[model samples]
Target chain A: MDLSRISVVVRMRSARQAIDLGFVMACAWWKPLFLSWLIPSALLYFLLTVLFHHQSWVAIWGVWWFKPLLDRAPIYIAGQALFDVKTSPLQCVKALPQLYKSDCLPWLTWRRLSPSRSYDLPVTVLEKLKGKARQSRLRQLHRENANAAICLTMVCIHLEWLLTLGAVGLALLMIPEEINVASQAWFVPQEGPMLWVQSLLSYFAMAFVAPFYTMAGFALYLSRRIDLEGWDIEIRFRHLAAKQARKPAAGLAAACLICFFAGPSFFDPPVWAAEISAQNKGPKSGSASSRAPEYERVKKQILEILAGDDFHKPVMTQGWRLKKRDAENPNGAALPEWFIRFVEFLEQNNAGPNRIAAWFGRGARVLEFLMWSGLAFLTLYLLLRYREGLEAFARNAAAKKQQGHPPNRLFAPDVRPESLPEDVPTQVRRLWQRGAARPALSLLYRATLSKLMHIGDFVFHEGHTEGECLAIVKQSGEAALCDYTMRLTLLWQALAYGHHAPQSEAVEALLTQWEALFQHGQ
Target chain B: MSRIPLDTQYQVETPEGIDLEAALAGPVVRILAYAIDLILRSIVLTVLMIVLFFAGKTGMGLFLVLSFLLEWFYPVLFEVYAGGQTPGKKAMQIAVVNDDLTPICWSPALVRNLLRAADFFPFFYLGGLICMALGSKFQRLGDLAAGSLVIYREPPKAALSLPNRPPRSPQLSLSLEDQVAVIAFTQRHGQLSRARQQELAEILSDVLPCGSDQAVGHLQGIGIWLLGDRGETTSL
Candidate 1:
């Protein structure tokens, strides 16, 4: 009968819609990699290395990749759950367009027999859908924008730390052992006056150099990573799965190879260390020549000029000592911990702070403090100047956002009005078709439903996550039954709006993703 | 963190659509952030100890007192009581948060400040550094013991003109109330307080085309306007 054919057609339409949603769900898996894998994996790598130093190298290696996986899993699960939570008659409104183009009228425009084909659409339908679509779009835009900004902020934070904090750290690392040697009473005094300057140089070095190099290393790393990861693409792909896959992969290969191989190979002192068996090759040979009076005079002049010693301002370690103060009594009973410990430690280690002691008796602490102050001031001055670039960076960011247009993946989901059930009462069909968009939705609710469901289940009784829920259902029955349950579970996750309200676009995305799930046959 | 040229985004779907490219919290990004922190904190702490230790015991005690006092308020008290950081700690993205996991109050400051000794374990902050380098949340010994998190306090966002949103309408012309609502909505986020978010969200929610997007959309539009020629948007 004609009625039977119409019913069959409607069922087929619904089935197609459900299939399209499956593809959408499959696209959502990337979030787990970012939130769960990358950060946590890196974090765990450091954690295991630092905390469980006793662990064998093999364990450390094994744990390295786990963090990146775990880090993203939460977000992956959470984002997917968002799509799965809300189901309603509204979804039919979204599925209609796809059904129209792909199913009912795949080539309606193409069928214009006459050259003068009027391409008029029903204005009323468009007008009604426009409001919903615009609102839906704006919500999607806001969500995407916020997510992008947070990612960018994290990136910038990393970059800033690398430049500023890392700079200071490397500066400190450059400090030599000689500066701390001054506190020892009976050692390292064999040479002469040159030791005093050497001590000062070492102090400045550790106080300033270490932090600088460390920062440089970090900055270099960040800048490179940013170059390779293409985080922006990954973000877009969350909504546009097929498009992301289609995009050319980012180029991280060179940096990885270099960082892992050549970086340490060329720069690691322990690896590339040349034997100093040849005495003439040592810098010590230049030391003797530099000791000449004329050379000393040149060096002194240079020292005074460079004594812009502003770089020596802050010391690196809290316990990092400048040379210990010399006592008035050469034989003054050493009661102070610094002196006692310095003497004891130096003796045990066969080195002395004694050589630099002569320079310490008078105003050395004041001189050192002043040095640090100058360097700190200079760094501030440079940072202020550098801020001009920051303004430009901000301007560029604004421009980038404004110029950006969403890729095809960002298009509104398949739009269609659902067919009303024939057996239902006329009022029921009318009520179902009459969408209650008038209800004011809360963003707190829109953004939070999945979380609510999760916490709800946890608070109520489900011991596992929504993602795990399907697996559990699947395992609980016969194979064929399990498949059916999982499909339903996936659908339920896609459409169960469960007590919370959501923005229309988010809902559309859920519906689209749900359809993709079935369409992809995953 | 400045934007990196190499970073890319991918669309990831949840059961519902949600963004999760940061889902994995990427490698180089996290390591770089931590390394920067470690280097800065280590440098500052080392420098402080070096200065105080060499200053002589009296000088060291004076330095500690000076550090403690420096944390308090006004004329010289910018970072004390609630924010308890030396200049170095502040710059390094480290702060002394309190027991409730919020920023410390002056009294808690007084207690924790006095208790730095208990936190200082066997040699040269071996314990503290261990806690920071090894803990789940990157807590130091003091932070773990104090139940606080040290988060970065970022600089304020730049000022900007908001978007040219025509108030919801049959009417093209804006009434005074509508204009005021838009202004309040746009200016609120820069305030950086949760109270402000709630307050501002109230004003613009009525005028928005989509009630859900009101608060964020208003601000973003404003951001777009302020951006001028840059046309750059902060991407999600």
Candidate 2:
């Protein structure tokens, strides 16, 4: 293609790339933010349980899910860094002129290259051409650019998905076994097919899964982009003739798979697996005895936490407190029956009055309470942030309009009244022949505004009503005598369709007066 | 981007293509434009008032901008954003280009919105109208001092397909004198280089007969191939 057409293509492509890059980065950036909204809370929940109360290792290990901060950060950074690195290639992809300057081509030779054929057409024929030619060229350029941008964006999005999966896995380990197996998390069901869904989720809270997913997604996006760019073809050709490359390929693939899937298996051994193995080796009676005391204490404590009150203690109280119950009545520790039913209705399978009774369960039931309360906090935070995000977005977008238009004395002087030929008095013709006065006024407003603004004049700021604007002009004395000129514009805009002028005709009359004023100014 | 044909300091060029002088003269046609704008706007507003009476707040609310912003800065925004002319400016073959003869942008749009008062004097565009009528090139106050100019955007047309036929042989029948004349004429066509002009002229001259300037004129007078109607055009 010729230089101008090449330039158009390059520019169109670059802009498309910029937009795509922007979108990819935005999505990648948001992933961690969304993850941050959840995982941190889970970790905090598990950590708080460890700190505030002494829990046995078995009970504690059950809730271990999301990985450590160190693992999460590197994975998160990789997406953004990868996003940055991927987009970096686009920056190198610049204007065609710059492309010629790149290392691939010898600069001076390309810069000074000339078109092979000479194009000489008569001015008369060239003048017959229209602006649509330029516009079409621009549009074509944009389309090609948009395609390239789409490819890059898809790569980034795929990487984002992979990373999210890692986070989900890590979240499984951290799932606070209570939130998972016991349906502690709000609005979740604990049984039937829903139970299987619960297990898949529990996998994320299971600790090391996050880093694994993170690495996997990154690898996947890389592989995908490479494939799309046809880099795999180059790779295969490089390998086809070599000695077996399986060892290197297998090593790289294994390392990626292990980091993504097996990295966390090394941390925090499972206590339940040991118990299960031990139970298989011995009698059931022996296994039950071995689990006796410790299980009972945990069950007691977990029940209390679920009930939201201490059932073991009885305190003497005053009149308003009602009778100082003789025993530490466990029944009294529960909420009112109606309130229980209300809470049960909020849960799956709890459509009736007896639903709250379903809360009675083993040690991990505290997860249910934590999950329910967390739901409230999550919803409120999200709503507030969404509103704030909107306001912030607007404020950020409007930061550039303080400068003014160019000054008048910059253009070449002209002697002719109408820039166009007399035969092309478009507005004059429109006034006489175009539809009604509405179109005419619109034409007039446009023609007048264009004519006035072209004389090195400034348009208005958002402020300054016509009256206020006029006063400022009069006070400035720059064009004080300009009043009493064209009144048509204001009359047309303010009271055009009215039965009477209502002070508007006077405005229209002033426009004609402007013709007179100019004569006076000269 | 930005507008085109940026002005340079201390340099005078004979800009035959889209010159500033030519562009500034456009608004001369807009004086009558504003007069029409007045008539149309009045009629529309009158209808609007009746609509408002029947539809009440509902009608006004639906076309809220028409109720307020339309009169306020809608025209200014549209003009600035739409390349200086409203629908009116467009049909009139006028556009509001920057002082340097580039496209309109935000600041210019805002400035026009602000300085709209100066353009409007004594209730009408009396001030601006007069500026266009009496000032040089019929430019209004804004266009005069702002280095801006009202220009026309070229209409769309098909690309030029120049007539080109490779020469059969280098040894054309035409004489050197006719070749020189054709070369000189074609030299002024900017798209072709001097060498290309010479080459084309040589090819065109192939159809001419051996001759002096007078002889070539006589041959053309008799109707040679290159001598079509262009032969009668002596200004070349």
Top lDDT model: 2
Going through the candidates in the order shown, the clash numbers are: 162, 100
Instruction: Give one digit per residue, the lDDT tens place, for model 1 in A1-522.
Output: 111111101110111121112112222322331233334444555666566555434333444223112212332232223334322224433433442332113123332221111111111112222345644533433331233223333433333333333333333446686666343321232345433333333332222222221222222222222222322222222223233234343423222222322333333222122221122246567654544564456556545754676635766666665664455566555577688887787678755567446446446888988999999999999889999998999999998997796564332221111222222223322432355322212111121222223422312123454456445545555464345434434434444445433355554454344334322432
TM-score of each: 0.21, 0.21
* lDDT (Cα, 0-100) at A446 in candidate 2: 40
lDDT of each: 0.36, 0.40
Off by over 4 Å in 2: A1-522, B1-22, B32-47, B57-68, B134-138, B144-147, B156-236
For model 2, state the Cα shift of residue B13 in Å.
8.3
Model 1 misplaced regions, further than 4 Å: A1-75, A78-522, B1-83, B92-107, B113-153, B164-236
Candidate 2 is scored at a TM of: 0.21
